[model samples]
Target: MTTPLKILISGQHGQVSRELQQRLGDLGELVVLGRGQLDLSHPEQIRQQVRAVRPDLIINAAAHTAVDQAENEPELAFAINARAPGIFAEEAQALGVPLIHYSTDYVFDGRKDTPYVEDDEPNPLGVYGQSKLAGERAIREVQGQHLILRTSWVYASHGKNFLLTMQRLLQERPELRVVADQIGAPTWAGSIANSTRALIERWLAGRAGAWGTYHLSAQGETSWFGFAQAIGEHLLANGKPCAVLQAIPASAYPTPAPRPLNSRLDCSRLAREWGVTQPDWHSALRECLAEQG
Candidate 1:
């Protein structure tokens, strides 16, 4: 009898991590560590945890994801985002294990008229993006067997995301203004987890592609306004009151960290290489809501 694979996942309570826990349970014995257990801001702690786990695979689901907050705390952001990933890569390499690190579409400035592919040059508009980009580069510099998965607008039924926030606020407030200019897929955490499982299964079956960065988001795109409108529609269908949503440019909602005007990522490489695809944003949102019910 073969021993089950030992999978080490960081960020136990994150949107993606929570979904991963549900999806990947049958595949292996999971060793999941959240911020409380393994504070990612400390490089030594990261190295020690990975060394202690010495698992078959390392999935880094943790990140300092507060975009505007990162502007005030660049050191903490880089410590967790940039330095921690590098440490994981180093530890994973030492243990002869593959590392899977999540990245963000914020790495790009969102200037391109079309969707961004994997090779697009990144020009981050704020500290958050710059730090995440640094993490991507850190993993690459390690030159280990790793998959840097870049996704955007991540949400889940059970986390602090736009979907849940909109669900509540839309019912409470009479009117809400959402940014309409910025665009990206509202990728559900469950979809990301399912796709990740497919990728892992392919790799385990010896059909893996090149170990590098891949864009893993939902199929289509929409702005924040469109997403809010969809959420309102869902609430109304469920016999709940929703607010009147007003479409506004990103300028109307000034944040400390500037968001990309176009956050669409082309995920063809993931499909071509690993036969992993994603549901369209609307379809995924519907599915996520159904799961919530």
Candidate 2:
């Protein structure tokens, strides 16, 4: 009998990590490490933990995700986002295991009229984006087998995400203003986790040629305002009270970090290579709400 794959996943309580824990349980022996067990900001700790776990594969789902806060804490962001993944890559390379790293769409400046492709040149607008982009470069420089999955506008039924936040704020406030100019897919964490499982299954079955960066997100795109409106409508459909969603541009909501007007990512490569296609953002959101019920 073949031994189960030992999968080491970083960021235990994160949105993606949580979903992965649920999705990947039957496929392998999952050893998930959180901040308490493995602090990613410390490179030495990362090396020590990986050496100790010595798993068959490494999936890095941890990241410093505070876009505006990253401006004030660039060092912390870089330490976790940029430096830690490089260390993980080095350790994975030494162990002769492949690494799967999650990245963000913030690497782009959002100037393109169309969706972003994998090969698009990145021009980040803030420290957070720069740090994530740096992490991507650092991992590639290690010359190891790694898959960097770049996604955008992630949310889940739980966690500190746009969906839940909207659920709360819609009840608290009579009206709320959300950015209408920025566009991207509101990808469900479950979608990402399921896709990751499929990718891993294929790789373990000897499809090593699939190792590369891919854009993984929901099928379509919408602005923050549109997303909020949909959330409110969903709540109302379910007999819940929701606030009025006001559409505003990025300029109206001046954040420390400038947001991209366009965060849409073209995910044809993932569909072509892995046969993984994401449900539309609205459909995913509906399913997530049903799960919450």
**How many clashing residue pairs appear in each of the predictions shown?**
0, 0
Off by over 4 Å in 2: none
lDDT tens string, model 2, 143-172?
898999999999998889999999999989
Winning model by lDDT: 1
lDDT of 2 at 284: 90
State each model's CA lDDT, in order. 0.94, 0.92
Alpha carbon RMSD to native, model 2 = 1.2
- Measured with C-alpha atoms, the lDDT of residue 293 in candidate 2 is 86
Question: What value of lDDT does candidate 2 attain over all alpha carbons?
Answer: 0.92
> In candidate 1, which residue pairs get closer than 3 Å at backbone N, Cα or C atoms, i.e. clash?
none
